[model samples]
Target: MLSLQQLSKQYKNSELALDNVSFDVPSGQVIGLIGPSGAGKSTLIRCINRLIEPTHGAIYLDDVELTQLSTSKLRKQRRRIGMIFQEYALVERLSVMENVLSGTLGYVSFWQSFFRKFPEPLLQKAFGYLERVGLLEHANKRADQLSGGQKQRVGIARALAQEPSLLLIDEPTASLDPKTSRQIMRLIKEICKERNLPAIINIHDVVLAQTYVDRIIGLKAGKIVFDGSPSALNASVLTTIYGKEEWNTTPACEEEVSIAPVPNFQTKLELAI
Candidate 1:
C-alpha cells in the first residue's frame, strides 16, 4: 500500500537523518521500525507525511508520488495517512470527541472547523472510533483530564477517525507504563489487522515489537541494517542495530512480566464504510 524509493533526508547544515531507506508495506501489515536514539526512526515517519521535507528521493502511497504533489494536492493526500505521535497531541481544552473530530479537519471547511460544526455522520463515525479504542464513555471529558494511557487511546481514536489507508505511528507507547504500553501495542496491532490498514510503527522497545509486529526493520545511523521477521531478530542482529552490547541477560522485571490482553472490541467497531 505504501512504498519508499531511495528516501533520504538531511537537515540544514546537519548530517543526513535518513540514508536511502526504501521499503514496501502491504495491506494490513504492521511493520515495526527499531533503532537506538538518533537512528532516524522519527525522520522516516515525518518524511512520509512531509512533516519534514525529504532532501531527496520519493515516497509513494498507493502508487501516488507524494513528493511531486502541489501543496493543495498534498493536503488532500494526507487525509488518507493517519499519524500517531510519541506524545498524545490532543487539544488540552477540547473534549475528547472534539479532538477525535479534528482528524476530519482536512475534509471540512475553515468556518465549519472554526465553529466545531462537523457533519452528523462524521460525528457518529468519530464516536465509533472512540468505542473501538475503548474511549466512548470518556468522549465528553476534556483531553487534559485523561491519564497517559487514556490520552493515547484518544490519539488512536483520532487517527482512526480519518479512515486512513496507512498509519504512521511514532513511539506510540513511549510515555506509558510497560503494561499500558503493551495494551496500546496490542490495540494498534488488532485495529490495523481488522481495518486492513498498513502501518509503520517507530518503536524503541524491540521486545514489544517482536511480540506484536508482523515484521521488523532495524536501523543504525540512518541506514537500514536488518529487515526480516521478528523471529529472525536474534542477539547478533540486535547487537548490530544497537551496537556492541551484552543482550544475553534479560532484566528480571521483563522476564517475570507479560503483556496483558486487551479487551476484544473488534466486533463493535464498524470499520468498513
Candidate 2:
C-alpha cells in the first residue's frame, strides 16, 4: 500500500539522515523497522508520512505521490494514515474520551471540533474503541491520571478512532515494562489482523519486532540492509544494521535498559531540516 523509492534526506552541514532508502509496506501486512541508535529507522518512517520532507525521491501511498502534495492536500491524505507515538502524545488535561475524539478531528467540522462537540455516532465509536483497548472505565479520567501503559492504550484508541487504512507506530512500547510491552505488541498485531490495516513501526526492540511483525526491515545509517521474514534476520543482518557486535548477541536485558544522556525527541524536528 506504501512505496518509498530512492528516498534520501540530507540535513544542513552535510549530515545524511537517510541515504536513498527504499522499501514497501504491502496491503494488510505488518512490517517492522529495526536498528540501533542513529541508524535512521525513525527518519525513514517520518519521510514516508511527509512529517519530514525527503531531500530526494518519491513516496507513493497507494500510487499517490505524497511527496508532491501541497500542505492542505497532505492533511487530507493523512486522514487515511494513523500514527501512534512512543510517548503516547496524549493531551494531559483532557479526558481520555476527549483525546480519542481528537482523532476524528480530521473528519469533523472546524466549529464542532473547536467546541468539543462530537456527534452521537462518533462518540459511540470512540466509546467502543476505548472498550476495545480495555480503557472503558477510564473514559472520563484525565490523561495525566493514567499510567504509562494506560496512556499508550489511549494512544492506540485514538489511532483506531481514525479508522485508518495505514498505521505508523514509532516505538509504541518504548515506555512500558516488558510485560506491558508484550501486551501492547499483541494488541497492535491483533488490531492490524482484525482491521486488515497495513502498518510500519520503528522499533528498537528486536525481540518484540520479530515476535509481532510479519516482516523485518533493518536500517543502517538510513539505508535498508535487510528485508525479509523474522527467521531470515540472522546475526549477519543484525551486525550490518546495528554496526555493533553487541546488538548481534542473544536477546538480552540490555535492550530493555534505558539509554543514558537520553535522546531529545525535539531533535527529530531538527532532523527534518
Candidate 3:
C-alpha cells in the first residue's frame, strides 16, 4: 500500500541520514525496522510522513506521490498517515479524549477545532478508539495524570482516531519497561490486524521486533542491510548489520541477543561434518 523509492536525506551539516533506502509495505502487514543508534530508523519514519523533507526520491501511497504535494495538499494527505512518537507527545493539560480528538484537527475547520466543537460522530469515533486502546475510563482525565504505558496507549488511540491507512511508529516501546513494551507491541499488532492497516514500526529492540513483526528490515549507517522474514534474521545477518563484536558479546540473557545460536564447542564439532 506504500512505496518508498530511492529515498535520501542530507542534513544541513552534510550528514546523510538516509541513503537510497527503498522498500514497499503491503497492506495489513507489520514491518519492523531494527538498527543501532543513528542508523536512520527514525529518519526513515519521519521522511515517510514528510516531517523531515527528503533530499531525493519519491514516496507513493496508492499511486499518490506524497513528496510532490503542495502544503495544502500534503495536509490532506497527512490525514491518512498516523504517527506515534518515542515520547507519547500528548497535550499534558488536555483530557485524554481531547488529546485523541486532536487527531481530527486536519479534518475540521480551525474555528470548529478551536472551540472544541467536533461533530458527534467524530467524538464517538474518538471514544471508540480510546476504548480500543483500553483507555475509555480515563477519557476525562488529564494526559499528565497517566502512567508511561497509559500515556503511550493514549498516543496510540489518538493516532488511530485519524483513521489512518498506514501507521508510522517510531520507537513505540523505547521508554517503557519490558512487560509494558510487550503489551504495547501486542496491542499495536492486534489493532493493525483487526483494522487491516499496514504499519512500519521503528524499533530499537530486535527481539521485540522479531516477536511482533511479520517482516524485518535492518538498517546500518543509513542504508538497507537486510530485509526478510523475522526468522531469516540469524546471527550472520545481524553481525553484518550491527558489526560482529556488538552481536557476539551481547549477553545470552539480554532480550536483544541475536536469535541465531552461538557457535559453542559442541555446535562447532557438529558443523565439522
Candidate 4:
C-alpha cells in the first residue's frame, strides 16, 4: 500500500503546485488522477517518486517512509516504483529489447550494465514482458521505428521489466489514436489485475479513466475536490473540477470513441500537466 500524509509541493516563486494533497493507493487498485490543467496531478506523481521534492509531509510505501530515505537509499527503493511517461521515453537508438533491459540498470553492477551483460533470468523476464505487451515481434526493432502505440507498449514492457510494486503512469494514451488508447488502457488494467500492482495513472481522458480505472480522483487548483467511483461523476462534478463549461464525454463514432483530453490542465508550475 502507498500512503501520502499531507503532501504538498510549493515552487520557488511561492506557487503551490500541490496544496496539502493526501491520498492512499492500495494493492491491485488503479487510481485515475484527473483534473483540469494545473491541478497538480503531474506534480503529485512526480513528488511521490521524488523526481520533485515535496515541501512538506511524508510519503509511505508499505513499511518504509519514502520522504525520509537518503539519496542512495531512495535510488534503491525507486526500483520498486515504475514510471510510464506521456512521450514514451525510450532511447531512440536502442532496440526494443535493450530498452526494456534498461529497467534493470539499477540491479546490475556498473560493469555488467556497461557491458550489457544481464543475467539469463533477467533476459528471460524481459522477453516475457515483451510478449506480455505484445511487442516480442518488434524486440529487434529500434524504438524510433515503431508507431506511437507500439512505442508506448515498449515503454510498458520496460516498466514491467523492473518488477515494480507500484506504477506511476503519466498520460499513457495521450499520443495514440482512440482505438490504440483503448487497447493500451485495457492492457494496463489487465496487467494491474494480474500482478496485483497498485497504480496511480495521471490521465486526462475522463471517459477512458471511467472505463478502465478502479477509482477517480479529481483535482482543481492544486486541491483534491472529488474522490469517487466513475459512476459518481456527473456534469455538476465536472464543473467543480474543470470549472463551468459545456462538458461532453461522449464519442461521435459508435465504433471507437476518442474523446479529447480535458483542456491542458496544468498550473505551469514546472510540469503538473
lDDT comparing candidate 1 with the true structure: 0.87
Model 3 worst lDDT run, 10 consecutive residues = 264-273
> Residue-wise lDDT of candidate 1 within 1-273, one digit each (tens)?
999999999888988899999999999999999998898999999999898899899999998999888999999999999999889999999999999999999989999989988989999899999999988999999999999999999999989888899999999988888789889999999999999999999998776788799999998889999999877877778778887765555456644543422122111111011
lDDT of 4 by residue, 152-179 (tens): 9999998998989999999999888878
Alpha-carbon runs more than 4 Å astray in model 2: 246-273
Candidate 3 segments exceeding 4 Å error: 246-273
CA lDDT, every prediction? 0.87, 0.83, 0.87, 0.87
Any runs in candidate 1 off by more than 4 Å, and if so which?
Answer: 251-273
Error of 1 at 202 (Å): 0.6
* lDDT score, candidate 3, position 60: 97
Q: TM-score of each candidate?
A: 0.92, 0.89, 0.91, 0.91
lDDT of 2 at 28: 79
Error of 4 at 2 (Å): 0.7
In order, how many clashes per candidate?
A: 0, 0, 0, 6
lDDT of 2 by residue, 148-224 (tens): 99999999999999978799999998888888987999899999999888999888777677778999988877778
Q: What's the distance in Å from true for residue 173, model 2?
A: 1.2
